[model samples]
Target: MENEQKTYRIDGFSCANCAKTFEKNVKNIKSVENAEVNFGASKITITGDATVQQIEKAGAFEKLKVVDKNQPKPEKQSFFKKHREVLISGLFMLLGFALIIINDGQNAITTGTFLISIIIGGYQMFWTGINNLSKLRFDMKTLMTIAVIGAALIGEWPEAAVVVVLFAVSESLERYSMEKARASIQSLMEIAPNTAVIKTPAGNKELPVEDVRIGDIMIIKPGDKLSMDGVIQSGSTNINQAAITGEALPAPKSAGDDVFAGTLNQSGYLEVEVTKNNEDTTLAKIIQLVEEAQQERAPAQHFVDQFAKYYTPAIMVAALLVAIIPPLLFGASWATWVYQGLAVLVVGCPCALVISTPIAIVSAIGNAANRGVLIKGGVYLETIGQSRTIAFDKTGTLTEGHPHVTDFMTYGDYDREAVLALSAALESKSEHPLAASILDFTESEDVEYSTIHIDDFKAETGKGITGTIDCKIYSIGKPENFDDADAYQSEGKTVMIIKENNTVIGLFAVIDPLRESSKAAIEKLHKMGSRTAMLTGDNEKTAGAIAGTLGIDTVYAGLMPEDKLDAIKNMQSDHKVTMVGDGINDAPALATADIGIAMGKGTDTALETADVALMGNDISQLPFTVNLSKRTLRIIKANITFSLVIKLIALLLVIPGWLTLWIAILSDIGATLIVALNGMRLLRVKE
Candidate 1:
């Protein structure tokens, strides 16, 4: 039989080392085939037949609790309850200090109190560390355990007790920081209500969203939040889609309009037909993707992991040398040099360095998700921040996508309405991109063209269409066949001419207008030292006009899908390039670019293929995303530098025989706290 796969949310993980330890222990289980832990997200995946009890036992060193991925989270405990062991140990250590002051020296009572404190506070650490030491798995816990035991052997009972209590407190603080970073995804999961008022065949009934099936009708009243992704079946209303799109305005919606789960419906009742199940909703997918993204390691993170793999063992050897070298060869005191060596081991813990990159990535990704930007992983985030040029697909990306009839002019004996009606009559039978534009214009003018029947309709690819109305032959095609056609084409409009028996009657000028945010977005990118380029299948004249208006640095028009891909390749030779498109038509180029960004309203192919997604479908978010990525990179770099610098300073103290257990633990704790806090600043970034 094949191994079953299961994922669970894990609690009580304190540090990256502990997470690794838990993962290793689980993989050692007899029935387990493989196991992996996402420390940043505090979740684990296992492929085995191991029971929940078995998994929990594997993580018993940290007292970890495991629950099903879909289960409700357990309630939080009070501070005192959560830190009971640490608090009790601290009390005992304080009592031991008082007894020493009263007795004027170390006595049986003081020694016993300190011993009790060490056992209580360091129980888990010692258990895991001792096991690791036996296996020769040198992690932070192993190093700390060696240091504490050495301190006790040297008759430094008070210092050992202090080390245990301080280490426990530091671990708690690290755990709290991780939880704070993970809260962003947790908040997103709570956006939509679990139960919805679904209209059944018999009557309306409220049920869990999981029980709601596709095609079921949901009755949503004014001021109520939508519980599923669906199309409105009856009535009209304005929906605030801020939760999904991050747009401030409420979009007016009516029958036939699609609505997403977690949107607020304001004004008018609605009967919505569910289009997707609870797990398949757009909001749910966002949460899932964000959680998965946290597991991906950035380049800096990989480097740090590789560095730490050898760094700890190297520190262990160095400490061992410092402990014996001076006393054996240089005539130094064994007790003094050994004490310095133990302090070196404590200072060498890589807690801060191990967490530097992941915390920043998690916080920045979460903040971007909240602002309607989805960065697929840390690599893409880093690439986007470093990209010097961005290439955009013109249609649907920089424009409104659908063309509109901007100008209508009559020639010979035809009037504007007559020409529009005739064009609409013939276009109603055609399947061209511009067909809807003529039909819409005819309806707006009340031209009554739909009643006319077109006969023998013939469509000529890349040219025009021909048909008969009232037994009269009529044709609509490119205006280039007629005189004065250059006038409209010069202005970058697509001109379609109507003719009767080869004589031109009238013409319609259409253009796909630029998006309101396009020019401003392009300008913002330029200001940030990024070059902009436009790619389109449109004519050179039209593409140039649009590019000029937006101040884009380059334009590549009249290109096929393959041509766009080639263009991206060319741009990559000199600079890193990002391709932005609607995701479907631009798949080849999007895949070929250094980074691909898709519009949120684009097809499913775009959402899955692109490296990043602008969920608001607003180009303005592009600048904000770029800014956030750059800031996150800076923070990660700063954290790594600060952590190493602090560790280096603490190690140098051993040269003058000034290093002590108190200073070493304080340095480690201070570095961990500083890096965690600095990384968390990413969560405050806003658009």
Candidate 2:
């Protein structure tokens, strides 16, 4: 009486009363100890460990996520659930075989049992088939059901039984596999943190994200993430926003940067200035849009819907002809004609073919999720597979996005390495804006610098850095700060020019480098029948230099926010185009593309704007995702073809008396089973 207990996070809740209803239903468990639910939390906390499977079988969405007191992680798929669906279908197969072998060459029991199995295994499907047909439309299920039953009525027990069993098993496998595949996208909605910490003048507070409002100050400390859309009015650090921008490196952030919630602050501390509440946060919107887009459906899914509508009615008519015409028109014995008609019905069921497409797509979508690639659903999965062109945002998508000193042009009294040594010496002591520039130059080019002793140093923010190095005055500053306006061209990026003994030395250009994986990913995509293009607001020169370095096919330079969308539409008209960018200004373009892939390293809003979001900003996964989509689509088509051909040929043979009823039923079930296993092969497709 004091042992069992159960708990769950029940969603779509109406009220506490609804929770009570679930609690009451679950309390019936024999071993259950006690069930305690707090409606405010939307979760039931159980006292003792208990089996919750029975409750799950009571409803479709009522999943049993946890089985024990502590709410165990999702349980493994039950063994009973896996093989149990085949019971009725398997019985039909066994009955047809038994009738052929055990019953005398002409016995009533054999025929009766064969029909009984058909009735039992396919009764629901038979009713559904008729219902769909009665609506003046036919689908794959209707066709299969009509053929098998038509065969059975003609006394072809073997064919009738096999046809129904085959349809049943195939449909079951398709449902199971597709649902399993969709688990990936579903997982996104599952693991998202729903709560946020609210900051108040009276210390710190933990509250639900919904309770959070705009303009609230929140303390975002070490190891804590922003819970609402906010700005950094105070504090600074490097944030690893790979989940948003798909840029793996942590972006250095300071005051005034609009930081989003759900992005991890890898290091440093910040007092967040809240801009938007939970509803408007990047994560919520991304989840919402992805879901909406997934449900919108694609143009291709209609193909199957159309095929199923006509195919069913047409096949039923064929089965009727096979059963009734031969004896009436050709003088064949009633038993032989009926048996052959039965064979036709069994083999002609198109259940496998009908379900193959969605199952494969759903599975691929799910598979991408497992790899941290959030493909919205079958719709986006199919689009990605069909893409012939890919547009990449250069800043964070194709580059390291970490601004580092790359090339240094030297000028005066100091040799290249001497100027580097002198600058490193004086700049090392100052906490200035250009410190990263100096450090990057030394590390990247193997430039060795001896210590330049500094006696006097000074820095002016938005101006430049100056210091005494080894009894000499050395300074590296922007042109505007040096009172030397004509010394060098602006060169676009903030240029750092060196001046020693009042003479201009060298100018060093600083830019973030391309990611190690970007070049390889571009090459691989080219090999996979996709051309790569770059879209950036960067000027023609910088964009051109990067394009040449990476060998990208096209570059759209000086593009404003709105222009990106038009660019995407142009590419999309001829070849399916996939847009990859850091989410933000790229939202419209991402939405316009055939498939929008957002780098996880940026804003949640940006990630939400696309069809697919990468969790790891590694460019390598882009190739992997595209290839995975193609592979999944290929498998879906193959499975559909395989299932359809077997069913059609089997039905065709039955009318001509080439196939026995027993052979028809076995072939139908066997083909459906094989198609299912083949579709599952997608789960194994890897980069």
Report lDDT per candidate: 0.88, 0.65
Superposing all C-alpha atoms, what RMSD in Å does each candidate have to the true structure?
3.2, 12.4
lDDT of 2 by residue, 83-153 (tens): 45457556756865766676556377766667677766776666655765676544455556566656656
Error of 2 at 343 (Å): 3.6
Model 2 misplacement above 4 A? 1-119, 126-137, 140-152, 189-294, 324-329, 332-335, 377-380, 402-509, 536-541, 555-576, 586-595
Clash totals for all candidate models: 0, 22
Structural similarity to truth (TM-score) of each candidate: 0.91, 0.62
- Worst-scoring 10-residue span by lDDT in model 2: 58-67
Indicate which candidate wins on TM-score: 1
Q: For model 2, give the RMSD to the true fold.
A: 12.4
User: Highest lDDT among the candidates is held by which one?
Assistant: 1
Deviation in angstroms for 33 in model 1? 2.4
Model 2 error, position 123 (Å): 3.7
lDDT of 1 by residue, 6-106 (tens): 88889888988889889999999998999999887788999987888998999999899996646776788898999999999999999999999999999
| Lowest lDDT block of 10, candidate 1 | 600-609
Give the lDDT of residue 155 in candidate 1: 93
